[model samples]
Target: MNETQRREQLKKIIEESEPISTGVALRYQGETKRVCVYRIPLDFLVYNKYNGRISSRVKAYERLNHELNSENDEDRELIEKLLWESKVERNRKTMEDLVENGQMRHGIVTADGVIIDGNRRASLLNRAYRERDKHKWSPVDVDKCRYFNAIILPQDAGPRDIQQLETTYQMGEDDKLDYNPIEKYLKVRDLTDVGFDIDEIAKMMNESTADIKKWQRTLVLMDEYLETLGYEDMYPMLDRVEDQFLSLSKGLKDWQDRSVLAKANWEYSDADIDDLKVIAFDYIRYEQEGKEFRRICKPGKEGSIFQDRLIWESFRDTHFETMDAIAEESVDEEIAHAHADIDVVDVLRARDSKWKSEISDSFKNNLKYSVRRLDDRMEDAKPKEILKKVRDLLKEIDTEQDSFLNDEGVATLVSEINRMTYRLKRELGQ
Candidate 1:
C-alpha cells in the first residue's frame, strides 16, 4: 500500500479495537479456571506513554497478539527481535547469547516501582518493550529467565528508599563489565569458583597464566593502598608490576627484596614507574659493565683541565711579545748572533767579548795623541797640570776598558742598551 493508505488503514484498525487498559483484574473460569483479564481506564493509563494510547485491556492484548502473529514470537521475544534489528544490534546479540547461556536474565516492571533486583534484566526488557515496533527489532525466545525473589515495597515508599533499592539492585544484578585488568581478575575469580582451571580461565580471558597471576597479586597489593593512590595513579603501575614479576627468575618476594625493586619504592606517586622499571632491568642485565650517566654542565661553567690547557696556550701565544736587537757596529757578527740567542748566559758572554774588543780599539787610537799632547804642553806653562790631566784621561779610558772586560759589568751594559733600544723604537712607532 501507499504511505497514506497504510497509515489510514493502521489508524482505522486501531480505532475499531478496544482501548488499552489502565488497571487489570483477574477472573477465574470454571474448573481449570484460566484467568480472565479486564481493564480500568484510570487517568494514568488513559494517557500512557508506553504504547502511545489509552484503551481497554483487550486492545493491549490485540497489540500483543498482532506483534506475536506478525513476528511469530511472544511479547518479550518480539521485543528482543526488534532490539536486535536496532542500532545496538551487536550488544543485543551478546546479551541474547548471555541470556541463552544462563549468564543473563530478563524481566518487566512499572517505571515507578523499585527495581528490588534484576535491574539489568528489567532495563533491557523495558527498552525492548519501548522499541518493539522500531525497524531494528527482531524476535527471540524469552521463556528461559532468572529472577530474584524480592519483596515489593509499598507505593507510599519515599523516593529515597526507591532510589536506594534501585542502586542496590543495579549493583547486585548488573555484571560489572569493564575491559580492565581488575575486571578481568574479577571475571577470572568468578570463573575459578565454578571449577575452571587457571590456564583455562587465562585462555578464555585472552591472558597468559603469568599475566593473570600478576594481576591477582597486584589486586591484593593495591587493595591496601587503593584509597591513597587511587586508580589514576595505580593503573600504569599494573603492567610494570606484571613485567617485574614475570622477569624474576626467583620468587616474587625475592625480586621485591632485591635492591632494584627496593629503589622503586619511592615511585608510588603518579610517577611513570614502568620506564624506571625497564631501566632497572637494563641495569641488572648490564650491571658488570657499569652504568653511564650523563653529567650535564651548565652554561658559563669553567671547562675541564684539557680545555683550560688549550685556552692557556692560545692566550700565551696571542698576547706575550719578545723582541731582541743587536747593532753590527757594537759587536762582531758571531758575537751579535750569540747575543740575540734566548739563552741569557751565552748572550752575556758574547756581549762581554764584543765590548772588550771595542774598548781596545778606542784606547789604541787615542793613546799616542794623548801622550804627545801632554809632552808638547809640558815645556810651556803648568807642565804638571797638563801631565796630570793627561794621566787622568788615560786612567778613565783604562777603567772603562777593564769594566767592559768584566762579565757581570758587560751583562749590565747590554741590558741597559736593550732597554734604551726598546724605548726608542716604541717612541718612533717602528
Candidate 2:
C-alpha cells in the first residue's frame, strides 16, 4: 500500500481496537500481543534514550518544564527549545527538520510505552502537550500534540527483540547515530546469545561480518581480561581501551602459528593469558605517560614493545617471573605510569635507580634508528633526490649540533657527518 493508505489503515485499526489497558487488566504481560498503531498519551510514554542520544529523562523533563513554563510556549518555539537544550546536539538538526515538517513517520514503541525510535520527536511532542494546559501559544495546536502516533509492538517483544530492533533502527542506517564501540559490543553479544552467528547478525544488522567478529573477540578478551584483573565491574573503562584492545588482539593473533602461544587451542594458555592480560594493563599505563615515555619503550615505533613479538620474546624469556610480580603489584597500586622499555625487566630486576634518567638516554637509540632509516631511504632515492636530502641533512646537522651539550657525543656525530659528506660527494661526482 501507499504511504497515505498505510497510515490511514493503522489509524483505522487504532480507532476500532480498544486502547491497551494498563496494570493487571492488561492481558499481555510481555511484548507478545499484536502489532497495532496506538494514539498513546504523551504523559504515558516513558523516555529511555541510550548511547548518548538524548539527555537523562529527569533532565529532559526539567527542560520540558522550563520551556512549558515560559511565557511564549508556542509549538515551533518549544521544539527549538528542546533541540537547543539537548545534551547531544547532533539530534538537533534532525529534530528541527521533523518540527518544520511535522512527524510524517511513526515511532516504534513498546506496549508498556517505552519509545524505541524517534525519541527526540516523541519527547518534543510530549513537551508540547505538557505545556498546553499551562501556557498560551501564538499559533496553538495543543490538541494535535496531546497524543503521539506510534506503532506499538506486541507486549511479547522481549528484551532481545527490543535490543535487536533498537539497534537495527538506530545504528543500522548510515545517517543514524553511531553506536559507541562498547555499546555495539554489547549488542553483538546479545545477538550472539539469541542464536545469531557473526555472518547472520552482520547481514541482519547491516554491518560487516569482520566488524562483528572483531567486536565479539575483543569483548570476550576485555571481559576475561577485566575479570582477571579483579575489575569486572569496570567494563565502562573498555570504551577508552578500544584502540589498545584491538591492537593487543592483533598482537596476540600474530602468535597463533607459534607453538608456545597456540597451546591453549590457538589462544594463550590460562596462565599465559593471565600474564598477557596483566601486561596489557601495565602497557596501558605506560602509554598514558605520553610520547616522551613511549619513545623509551619502543624507541622509534608508535606502539609498545609488548606488541612486537621478537622484542617481547626476549623480555618474556629473561624475566617472566619478574613480569608476573610487577603485574600483580602494579594492579594493586593501580599504576598509571610504568616503565616503557621492553628491558623493563632488567630495570625491575636490578631495582635500577638510573632507569628514570634513561628516559633521555633512549633518544640516542631513537636517533641511531632514525639515521639508519634515513640511510636506507637515501640508498633507494634517485641521485638528485639523494643530493637534495644530503644538503638538507648537512644544514639540519649544523643547526642541531649545538643541541647536544655532550662534547664526546657532538664530536662523534661530526665525525660521522664528515664521512657521509665525503661518500656523498664521491657518489654524486660533486
Best by TM-score: 2
lDDT tens string, model 2, 84-113?
Answer: 454356544544444345566666776566
Q: What is the C-alpha lDDT of each candidate?
A: 0.34, 0.52
> Candidate 2 — which residues are off by over 4 angstroms?
1-38, 48-87, 94-99, 127-146, 225-235, 256-274, 285-310, 313-430
Please give the distance, in angstroms, between residue 145's alpha carbon in candidate 2 and its true position after superposition: 4.6
The CA lDDT at 91 in model 2 is 48
- List ranges where model 1 is wrong by over 4 Å: 1-126, 133-181, 192-197, 203-206, 227-255, 259-430
TM-scores vs. true structure, each candidate: 0.22, 0.51
Q: Can you list the residue pairs that collide in candidate 2?
A: 30-155, 30-156, 31-154, 31-155, 31-156, 31-157, 32-155, 32-156, 297-340
- Model 2 lDDT vs. the true structure? 0.52
